[model samples]
Each structure stands twice: as C-alpha cells, then as structure tokens.
Target: MARRGQRQSGATRPAPQRRRPARDADGLLPVLARAVREVESAVERSDVRPSVRTKFQVVALLVREERSRVNADHTSSDAYRAEQLRRLDGIATILAKSAARETTLLGLLAEDAVISEAAASLKREMLIAAGQEPPREEPVSRPTTPADTTVRRVVPQTVVQRQLANPFLAPDFSSAPARPPRPGRLAGWELITPLLRSFEHAAASASKALPEPTTLRTAEGLELMPHQARLIASAAAGHRTFLLADEPGLGKTAQALLAARAVGAYPLLVVVPNVVKTNWAREAGLWTPKRNATVIHGDGETVDGFADIVIVNYEVLDRHVGWLGDLGFRGMVVDEAHFIKNKKSQRSRNVLQLSERIRTRAGRPLLMALTGTPLINDIEDFTAIWEFLGWIDETGPRAELMESLEETDLTPADPGFSAAARARVIDMGIVRRRKVDVAADIPARRIADLPVELDGAIGRSIRDAERELADRLVARYETALATRTSGSTVDGIDHDLVRRVAGWERSDRDSAKTGENVFSLVRRIGRAKAGLAADYAAQLAHSVGKVVFFARHIEVLDAAEELFTERGIRFSSIRGDQSRTTRQKNIDAFVNDPDVSIAVCSLLTAGVGLNLQVASNVVLAELSWTNAEQTQAIDRVHRIGQAEPVTAWRIIAAQTIDTKIADLIDAKAGLAATALDGSDDEVAASADFQLEALVALLTNALSE
Candidate 1:
C-alpha cells in the first residue's frame, strides 16, 4: 500500500511528447482536461486521502492561472484564440459545477487565497503535463541579526512568576498506547469520509444512552438533571473526553463543571466566546464553589494565577496560550465549539494547538466540546469538534476511534458500514439530547415569523432598490452567457451562472462600501423597518412583562431605543462598543431589574452567551444573516429557568428580500436539527443561503 503523503506514482505522468502549439492553448487544453478528469474522479471516489478540499483548491487555482494565460496569449490567431478561450471556458464551467456541489469550495476561489505546498506540487505536475516549465520558486532570505530574528512573547509578570515558581512541568503520556490496526476488510482505506458519512446516513434519533450516575447533586447544592447526571457519571467512570452537544438551556455549563469535579480535573481551563467569559466564571462559582475561578482580562491585570479554574475568551487566547499550556491544566472545555468549524481560522488553530499541549502535559485530561448546534452547515463541521475531544486528528481517527473501526472489519463499500461506524464514534462519548426530548425540564419555545407590509413612499423605494439589485445581477448573467461561444447555451437559467454572478457581486460588496449589493439592500430594508419593528416591540413589552429586542445595525438599535424612550418604555442597551463592565451591568439590569421592560441588544454582541431568561418574549427587529445567529438570539430568552412559553417574533418585511431570507433561515435550520436534534429532515447548507437568495431574486425579476 502507498504510504501517507507519498504522491501517486502514475497520478500525473507527463503527456506523450508532441509538437507544442505557438500559444499556450495547444499545450494547455489537453493538460487541463486531463487534470480536471483526475480531480473529478478523485472527488467522486473519495480517494484524496488528505481532503477533497485540497484537490478542489488545486483545480480552482489552476483554472484561474490558465484562464489568465489564455486571455493574454497574443501569438495565436484571432479565430484560434477565440476557440481556445471557449474551451477554457468549458473547463471553468466544469469547475463551477464541482464547487456548486460543495458550497465550501467556493471560498477557495478567492483572489487572495494562499497556495499550500500540496496544491503547488499538483500545479507543477499539471504544468509538466502541459509541456510548460512552472514558475521558479523565489529563495527566502533569513534575518541576519539576533535583534531582527528573535521571537518573543509578551508574558505578564504574574504569569512569569507562576511559571518561575513551578519550573519542572513534566509531560504525561500514560493514557493508552496507539492501537495496532487489526486485520480487516477496511484495513488501509481513508476512513474519515466513511466515518463522517455514517453520521449523515444514520437515523437522527436521541444519542446513545450514557452510563447511569452514582450521584444526583453537586457540592454547591444544585440538583443535577437526569441527563446531566449521566454525563457526570460517565466522566467519573473514566470517560475523560466528550462532545457534550445537548441543546441550549439544558444546563451544559453545570454538567461540564460538575464533571470536572467528579474526575478531580482541576486547574481546569475554559475557552469560550468573549460574550460568555464572565458567564463561565459565574457558572463555575455556582456549580463548583469550592474551586477558585478567575477570568483573564487583557494583560492579566488582576488575574488570580493561583485559582483552580481559568476562564479565557477566544479573542485573547493568543497572548495567554503560551503560559496556559505551561500551567498544567488537568482539564479543558471549549464552549460554542462551532466557532472553530473553519480549521484554517486562527482561533481554531490556537484552540487545537493548546489542546495538543494540554494532552502532552496532562495525559488523559478531561476534554469537552460543548455546543448546542455542532453541525452548522455540513457534516464536516464535526472535524474541529472531534479534534478538540481528541477522538480524531487531521489525518484520520486517533487511537481509540481506530480501534473501534478496526473492530468493525468493514469498508465504505460494505453494507451497513455507515451505521456501524456512527455507532462506534457515538460510543466514544457523544452526549446529545434535544429540548423536545426533555421538554418538561425546559420551557417550550417557538419562532413566529411576523410579516409586516410597507405601503408608503419609503416602502416603494426599498422595493425599487431590490428590483434594481436583481436587474443588475440578471444583466451580468446575460452578459456572461452572451460572451460565450455559440451552441453552449441551455434552456433554463443556468444556476451556476447565477452563483458566479452573485459571488462576484458579493465580493465587490465586501471590498467596497458604496455599492448597492444584497448586503446593502438588506441593511436598507432593515433601516426602513426599524420603526415598525420597534413599535411592535414596545407594544409587546407593554402587554407582556418584559421583551428582548435584537437588531443587527447600530442605526436600527438607535432607532429602536429612541422610539422606546419616546414611548416612555424603559429599555437597557447592550452593544459591542461597550466595555466588559458596562455590558455586564446592562445585562444585569435587563435580567434582574423588573423596571427595565426592554433589552435592546446588538445581535452580534449579545447573541451567543448572555442569559436573559427573565424575558419570555423576544422581538427581532432585523434578520440575521445565518440561522445559528438567529437561534442563539432566541435561546437567550427560552433557556432552562423560564416559567412561560418563549416566543421569538421575527419581523420580516413583506414583498421584499426579507421574506426570502426568513424562508432561507428556516431551510438552513434543518441542518442543526438533523445533526444534533436527531430529526430526519432534508436541509440545505447555510453556505448556499446567500447564493440561493440571489437566484430567487433574479428568477423573480426575470419572470416579471
């Protein structure tokens, strides 16, 4: 069998010697065709051991380079050049279709994307196949002086003192040895895809049963729910790692802390989103009062280096990861694990690197990844989560999972392998239970979409803006089709063309602020609807005791707050610009003070972590771009302790893109339901939402 990282010997053998064309077209066409065929086959057969994403990136990068070359080749005749350009366009069309199947691949086509070593090697091989010399690598120069080359970390005095006080930290590797691969039918295949596919194909039922607990209460006098207790018991019984994916408001924070206590995994480390850093400390105090907890602020001005528990946010992890790794933390917990879904992200890299260090220093330390929605867009979202729990690494399954897969003695081609593979991973410790399954333990929650009509001149202007955006996109699409060579047109609207046009517009929208793209149009609609939504929220606050109002833009929040003030309704504001202390104070006012009837929140700032169960009704003044953000907003009010049924009033504008986005959000929500809630529903990936929304708008405009 070929070893890992070894290039396939016959993968891209050079094409047979032939007369090179005057222009790159003759030399590149056959090579591009062969490369595309090879990549498509690899993707179809799942033979790219590292990742199909890498191959996709390679194809995309090559397509971009070849297109530039074909367009600039001046030596060829006009007729010949046009013919070559058409063929190149055909290859590009194929690349677009491939990317469309997997929405994540579209991100690799960005202009500033960096080429990895593997991708560069593949590109060189393709160039060799085309009988062209690849570009020469530039030599990297080294810094000459120590002052110029030395790397330093700005360690705080307190952290330095702690490290100096305990200088002899030993590495621990006593958990278990790497299990030998057993003789089986699936002995040498790339198993990650098959493993992930198992989750995709398996029934979305309640997760497998956890071991029964020996205790039901914490030392702090807080009673544990049956499900929470089972997880604690599992940890107590030596199950040191878990993907604790119980739905929100199910006491996940309490369960994680108590589980640490059960295993004596103290000197614990908790990495959470910035909004929840303070909340983690609060939860630690409530559930594990005996253990001292400290929250690290910038520069650690008042950090308690001696505390038994350390809580840090993702934003500041880079500065503290160096010392935290040396502090000998016996346990680690990452809240909102989905934040690390993109493995290339800096936060994800830092989290994974720190987790690796913890494993080395405290062998078999308790590690947990807690999130309500683990699979946000695709099944592969589980990759980072699994890595955090130490169940799998980038290459493939780690020790424990490999042993289980070996026991199965089956391959992806075998019958019933997916279910068996899923069971194995779940058995490793994936605790998932939805609110509906434990409805009696938590308040019932529902999302009600409230469509409001805009009938004034302002409404007509917003509608006109939407029509103009759609027309612009349709014009671009038609222009692209008209420029194509004859006989390549299709009957229906080319959805691929639609996505490309949308992607180009979205790219332009991101780089420039003046354009009226989908983003700007949506913001305009939000601005137009702000008054109406705020008025509705004020009415709801008067009828219902308290209301939590969420909006995306500062102008919308400003408008909402002004309207509330004008109406004589008391409201508290929580925004991203406020300091930690002020933010916490505002949150406290909203939760504890009954006189505050409304909590006007910035959806991006107050969405994930702050608990606002004091309010049973939530008014979304503007729509969020993703379903996760929307759900996180509503969960603040619908969590565990609320006594009444929770309702989220999503104020969407009628006869506009707002309605389409709301529908798209609902469609995307099914992904989380299928993965975490065990629902058997078909779902579109959230990555496709932007493109699909654009398609719907353009199709609407064309029909009109």
Candidate 2:
C-alpha cells in the first residue's frame, strides 16, 4: 500500500525495457528457469556482480515454478484444480489494477532504454576513434507469450466521440411485464395512490360531516408518540374497521381511541380478553375525557348508556352476542382476534353473528380487530377472521376458505389457480409491521447454548443400557411419532424411551434390593436438572442488559427460580397461579427497578399487552404449536421504547420431538416475512424451520 501510494504521488520509478522478460502459458518455464540459474550462479561467483536483469530472471523463475505446481495436479486433486482456476481469474483482476499504476513507470523506462542504447553507441564510436576496444552488445528480441504482450495502444479520439461514449454500464432490467394499475380516484398517482386515496377520503369526510375542527382536542395528559400517531392515521384511512395489529406494549388501544376521535366515529365497542378489561378501561380514562369512555363488566345499563365508547371482553361479547345491537354502536373493535381464528369456535361464531346485528342499524358498523399474532399458524387463520370481518369475501366454511388461501396445491402447474390472481389478492387488506423494519434503532440481542457433562459412572450405565436396546428404542420412538398421532403423545413415548434406555425404570424385584431403580432415577433426575440448568445459565448469561424468561409449566418455572435463587440472580416472577394484582406489581418492579435483571412468567398468563421494555432478552422454556401464542409472548420485550434489540431464544433438545415442534411453530410464524422486513431473527428462524418439510421428516422417521 505504501509503495503504491508513493508511486501515485509522482515519485521517480524504474524504467521499462523491451528485453524485460519472455511470457508464456507453459512453454517459457524452461527458459525462465535457465535465466534464474544463470543469475544465481553469477551471484555466487565471487568475481561477478548480479544486474537488475539477473534479479528479474530470478523472480520470473519463482513465478514459473509456482504456476507449474498449480497446474500439475489440477485434474488429480480438487484443491489444486480450484487453485489453478482461481489464479486464472485473479490474473485479469491483478493486471487491471497494475495497469493504472505502472503506465508512467513503463513509459519512462521504455524512453530511458533508447537513451542508454544511444549513449552506448556514442561510447563505442569514441572508443574506436581513440583506438580502444568497444563493449560487447546483446541481441534484442520481443516476447512470444501472452504474459509478455504489451498493452494495446489506441489512437487518440476526438472530444465528441469521448463525450458520446455510453452514459453508464448496462442495467439489469426485469423481463416481467408491468402490472395493470388498480382502479381508484388516484389511478395514475403511482406508488402513493392507495395512501393518497384513503387519506383524501378521510380528510374530506372529516371536513364535511364531522363536528367543527375547533371542538376536537389534541389528547391531553397522555402524550402521543410519533408511531402512535402514524398507527392512528393509517387506521383511520386504510380500513373502514381497522385492526390495531401492532405488537404488544405499542399502545394499540391508545391508537384506536385516538383514531375514533379523528374520524368522529365513536359510540364504539371495544372487545378485549377478560383478563385485560380493567387495564383497558383505566388506559382509556387516563388518555381520553372522563365521561366519554365506560367499561362494561356485565353491566347492561352502562353498555346501553349513550357513552362515546363502551369496552367489553370476548367472554361477555359471546354471552351477549345479539344484545350488542341494542346498544346502537357505530363501530366495534376486536382485541386478540386470534382467539376467534378458528371458524368453528364459539367466540368466532358469536363475533360473526353479532357483526351482522351491529351492522343492521349502522350500515355495517366499522369492525376493527386488534392482534399481535395476526397470522398465527396458517393463512387460513387470516382468511377465517378477515372473511368474518368483511376484510375478505366469504365463500363458505373452512374447506372453501382454505381453498382460497391455497394452502395445498399452490404451485403454478396446479390448474386450480394462477400466480397473478394470487398475488393480487395478497396485495390487499394485509398491512404488517415487524420489529426489524420499524424497530431498527433498538439494541442488539443474542442467544447462547451451554452443554453439561454427566458423571462417568452414570453416563457409562446409560450408554450400556442404550446400546443393548438400541433397535427396540428406535422402533418405539418411530411408532409413537406417526403422522396420524399427536406430537405430545410422541413426546410422552420419547420420555419413557429415555427412562428405560437409561435403566431408570427396572422391573426386577431383586433390583430394588440394591436400590438400583432408585439410584438410576436419581441419576436421571440429575441429568435432566443439569440440562435445564445449562440452558438457563447460557440464556441468563446472554441477558446482561435486560431479559424475560417464559415458563410454560410450573415445574420449569420452579427449576428456573431455584437456579436463579441459588446463583443470587435478581428476578421477579408472575406465575400462572398469581393474582392479577400481584402479576401487575411484579411486572411494574421489573420494568421500574434497575436492579431487576430478569422477569420470569408463564407465557399464557402474560401473553397480552404488558410492556416490559426494560429487558431485551426473552427465553422460551417450551414452545407452542400456535404461532399467535408464541408471538404474543415474544412481543412482551420487543415493543416500542425498547432501547435494545429484542431477541427471543428457545432451548431445544437435539434429536428430541421438541425440536421438531419448535421448527414447525417457527415456520408457520415465518409467513409474516412481508410484515417483518428487517427482522434478522425472523430470517434466521425461517432458515431453521420448514413446517411442510418438518412434517415430511416426521413421516419418514415414523416409517423408518
């Protein structure tokens, strides 16, 4: 680099000569070697001194030797063949870089050679004039090989020809035909047309039919973030009934309330999970005017009152499905609509039926749904909920909806559909935001795995037992994992397989005398405990900033708590059995206290909107087949205000059925790629899991 820079600064350089060196593909190797030997021999001769020509000869010999070795074993060895090919490609790159630097050097050298030759001729003439002997001259010849070929010289071009040379290198243009424009008020407005049309209509409607602009108030006391405003504006403009699909802790409820104010379309009904009814009511009162919002906890009088907004839970909505119409609500919002994703469920049926009644008076009352895990495990889930809300057209039941989603037979060759039509349908109604694209300013997160070693004596016994019954165990494992069977059942069989293979469940009566079964059980327990501890330690170690550990089972939570307690790790738990008050208090402590390093909780208990941005790590002790549940759990740490990038890590046992289920869950959730544009975690997980491929793997395992 220094030498190159020096040359660039217009420093003096060595001259070039026509007698430089002969270049060849293979033929010049012998000549180069002879030149090198002669130079080396002369250098070694005490009487002779080596010249620049001798030094170049030596360098050329070394180059020839290296090239010969590269090509010699090119066919016999893959490494050598690759090396030779690499060198061939590298030559052009090296030459291109070298040409720019060496141009002046070469030109100067060539010119100097002419001067040297002239001076030598003058000296010879003087020597002959003075009656002295003239110096001997060597013959000059041009190189015959590709390597020695001089750079091609071209005649200077006129200014016009130079100016008109191609403007830039050719661009890679797509061969696909352009899409026909969608018919709309702003049809020719290009990419921003949809947003423009929606905004214009919203603005016009707000101006013409709503109350005076001065009558409305910017939300007081409760400060609105920029993203919150974007969410509200987008909701008011995009869908008649918008789904507040932001992740947990992003204040979807706040956005919904603000949007109601924007459109003057209140006298609204807010439906959420039973557990969060009070939280919603409290937020509403704090964010909006006191008398404008009312919470309906099985209160008929309160719901019937002419309040701006009435909030209810899903459980109550199902119970009073038809009665909602009597309230004369202008809009209805569904929170956690994933609960109603199953078309046959009572909640879904009730919501669908109630939608009809609510619309009867208000001209299809604006139906908005809120969910973080929108497309839980399948596209059919979306179809089911959206069709009910009139986001998409309803054909019939599950079978018909599944057909529209094209879960199976989606290939272009499948005569049932065309790719163009599918793309068109997908373009509408789905607007997703991911942690990576929108939440990129957040910090980085990581997950690490730790392996534990077992005692030699116990390990040896387990190994011996496993080896003796290897074939039997494989058969049993396979039989249990059949596609016709449930994965939980398969997991149960694998558990038993491990116990028996490790000789922890002996049936012999005499075996009890030496306490063999008891000892083996102890060993087994130790192994399991070690595995769990190792996983938790690795995850907790990665949680230096802030972290949330999710425990699906009480035993798992107990184990994690015990481990943390023993290690003196600071944490608070929101167990499944805890009261709502206790849950909230602990959550507050985790988020407010700087000393609190981790917050452990049951996924089901804390899956709703509970902002815990104080942490950046989320560890899932176990996985659910439902992507919605998993997503809601992960979003606890990933929402707005999180200073760090949130990472959700899962601890999976290698070669276990748990690994397979985790893979399937990840694949199903990965369909949200469009929604999660910059999500590195999502991209990595997508590569790790393939639901269809996993099912095939399970099938193959069962058959084997």
Q: Each model's C-alpha lDDT?
A: 0.75, 0.48
lDDT: which candidate is best? 1
What CA RMSD would you report for each candidate? 22.1, 29.5
Using TM-score, give the best candidate's number. Answer: 1
Clash counts for the predictions, in order: 1, 4
lDDT of 2 by residue, 490-531 (tens): 533354444333232233345445333323433343344333
Candidate 1: tens digits of C-alpha lDDT, residues 1-704: 23211333322434333332232455867777766666566544534333455556666667777778778988878898788778877777666655433333444565434455556655665665666666666122332232222111346677677778878866666666446455566666788888887776555662656888776777656777788898888888889888887755577888999999999998999998654565577778788988999988655668888789999877567557788878888899998787687676546777899899888778799999987663423779879888888888877888778888878877788897888888888888888886557766554887866666564477788888887788787788889888977667677877777777877776674523534678778888899889878866875664456889999999999998877765568889999999999999999998888889999999998998889988877999899878989989999887887767677878888779998999888867766676678665545443566676887787777666
Lowest summed lDDT across 10 adjacent residues in model 2 is found at 203-212
In angstroms, the error of model 1 at 664 is 40
User: What residue pairs are clashing in model 2?
Assistant: 15-109, 16-109, 443-644, 443-645
